[model samples]
Target: MSGAVTSVFGIEPGDHAYLRYAGDDERRLLRAAHVTAAAGRGERAVFVDAGAWGGHDPRALPGGGQVFVLTPGEAGFAGGRLDVPRLMRVLDAQADEAARLGLRGLRVCVDLDEVLAVTPETAPRGDGGGPGRCPLAVLRGRSRPPAVICHGDRARLPEAILPALAERHPLTLDAATALTRHPLLCVRPVRDPAGLCLEGEIDDSNLGLLARALETAPLDGRDLRLYVRRLRFADVGAVRLLAHAADAMPDGHRLVLHAPGPVIKAVLRHYGWDRRLVLEEGDRG
Candidate 1:
């Protein structure tokens, strides 16, 4: 599976890929080809069509993949409103079925902008009102999960939702940069408590990337918790950035560092960041 390129954005597993397209028929076919290639590599590809199969060719889809055409007022909706929970349940069932079939994992390609646009009232609340409650939030909370690609039309999606969307998704791509490759660093948003998770290694090479990720994090005046359990290494600069994030938190709110090992803990204490940040050991749970 390591040899297979499971994501259209070339991102690693357990990361969300955001793709911005111009909403043309050609672009739709290109997107289908990406998903089809993933399905050919033993991954169960599921594409949720917000366009309801208009101008798309099912014959182009690879074998052993599923495509759902979601109509706004379809029977799956409640009172003409798209049922977010029910939609999620259907995806969950697909994941289960994929596991039973002994496939690598499920790969979901969805156009959430269309979904949200149709159901304006069901738009996800971003003020930290509830943890792991929103559909997107619930999807991010899953551990050891599938590869997901979220599609959005550049002209159609509202500007207000892009920041929140980018925060949840690590790799953002557009039609022009869709095929470009990126460095390997897994930075994902935590769902239950609503924070950020850092995996893989952080070093001088990717410091700028890390800074941009931190800047775009949806802190929103709430306590920002960073889970670094899977983080293998952090240079001094990275540690300083973490300290700065803590210091930059709003008054009365704190930045919590979760599960930093002895080495990272010692570095933080040595730099006197122990006074600036709240450090916690053990599992994030």
Candidate 2:
């Protein structure tokens, strides 16, 4: 529910949150949070591939949000659904930590058991080597789903999430969605006449729109341009937008990108978009 303030995530015992994708990969809503927060908390990086259902390598991410199944000797439960009882155990363990971190209440959660049992290996999250027990440990946070159940009391579970729980794979949103819904800073350019101008930073809040623009929208063979006053060392949000922008562009479209500083230039160089996207002269007027 949009009215809900806090957030919570639930995952299977094997699925963990942090995962390290190659530099240019997108679709990292679940794992990216741990990574950015670790450095802020004076911690190192630890990647966990909570999405890997089949036999595949794990992604690098921060540590924590780890657990194991209750019955190792039991046969499988369902195709996609996790053993709800087992998941509740994992969530209960993390509940104290969640409380300490000052996380919002149950906003979102992911059922890793469903992700592994129901979804085929072909599913994006599942690294389909075979119909095997998911290697990736489960992880739960406040943002999206794939959350740990935290408790076995189904009756005690929030009534709001009942519908989500019924479905095999619940709808999982991300930070970008949160930002799009609620923004800290407003950055909209109003074009009336005379001189044209721009406003706002390529900040995390609006990065959701940028990603949506690139992933879902169609921009083929048309000319696309990003006019910025200046650029700086970008975050996962900014970098992801850039990558999505590049990937989502229509082949016929030529990119006309402009930046005002070397910080942005460094990022451009890192992603090697200079070749793919045409750089415009720095014009900060």
Candidate 3:
């Protein structure tokens, strides 16, 4: 709501780097700001390099010197290929999220043949680069080359993992976006001593709800039991909600996010909850 940019990196929200923290118009504006900021810093260029699964965003900023994204290719039938509708949805989510990060106007580049500029280009004849092929990642900035050479250890990746990327990519990306916009989101579950159970929606809509639940728990006294089954379905919004909730937690109360995170735990991991939200016995406080 405040769209405060939290830090110099603008990595956090309290810094006021964003506007709505979760909207298109606001995201676009903020993204533009980031782009401008990056440019101001004297950075040569910015890139939206796609991952192996071929991440898609609704729009890629065209004004920048150059911008691109990775998409599925027939390289080896890794994930077969996603249909247009599916690709668009993924693209849209990515585009929206990117905008929030201040990289609006991005465009999708379908390169399955590994035709783009990959890092460690030309392979290490003997420098610091690898001798074999290079790996793929969300590369950005400097000169903004056209994906020099697609490289990454795709051998271990299950062929189907590529196809299934769509199934989980959106959720993963959304969770990440939300966390960036609201790093304050974190949790500490308090269980019920009489009956080990925690009831609440792990979604962003109810961050406040989760906070309320945590507030009523007696975490400092006993080990609290928590069920994150309810948190499996949430977006960046929830992260902010969580951030808001965590910022209000009482000292000494512990929260436990009970294993196997819903979305990629890495998405929320960066915020680094660090006992900030303690998980203990049920809400018996």
| TM-score per model over all chains | 0.47, 0.30, 0.31
What are the per-residue Cα lDDT tens digits for candidate 2 across 1-285? Answer: 111221111111122322112221222443444334322221222221233423333322223422222222121234444454554454444444443443311212233333443333322222224443232323333233232221111233344443333332332333333213222323233222111122333455566655544443322236545554522223434654565566656667665455534334444564465566666664442
Ranking by lDDT: 1, 2, 3
Q: After superposition, how far is residue 11 of candidate 1 from its true place, in Å?
A: 2.7
Report the poorest 10 consecutive residues by lDDT, candidate 3.
11-20
Off by over 4 Å in 1: 1-9, 52-62, 66-85, 100-102, 118-134, 160-164, 180-285
Misplaced by over 4 Å in model 2 are 1-198, 212-221, 230-233
Q: Worst lDDT window (10 residues) for model 1?
A: 125-134
Q: What is candidate 3's lDDT per residue for 1-285, written digit by digit as tens?
A: 112223211221111111122333433433343443333222212232233212335235454443333334322112322243443445455555555555422322232223322222332111113323112222222122111111122333334333332231111122124333334334553434321233222343456755565556554353333444333233344444444555565564334444423231433553464335533322132
Clashing residue pair totals per candidate (backbone < 3 A): 0, 46, 55
For candidate 1, lDDT tens digit of each residue in 1-285?
A: 122232353444465677767767545664665554443334567666545455456535445444333343331333323555666677678777766665545666667665544223333333223212224434565765666677777667666656556555566666555543233568898777777888765655677888887777766357777888876445556778888888887789888888875445655775588899888776763
lDDT of 1 at 38: 48
Candidate 1: lDDT of 263? 42
Instruction: Name the candidate that leads on TM-score.
Output: 1
Cα deviation of 152, candidate 2, in Å: 48
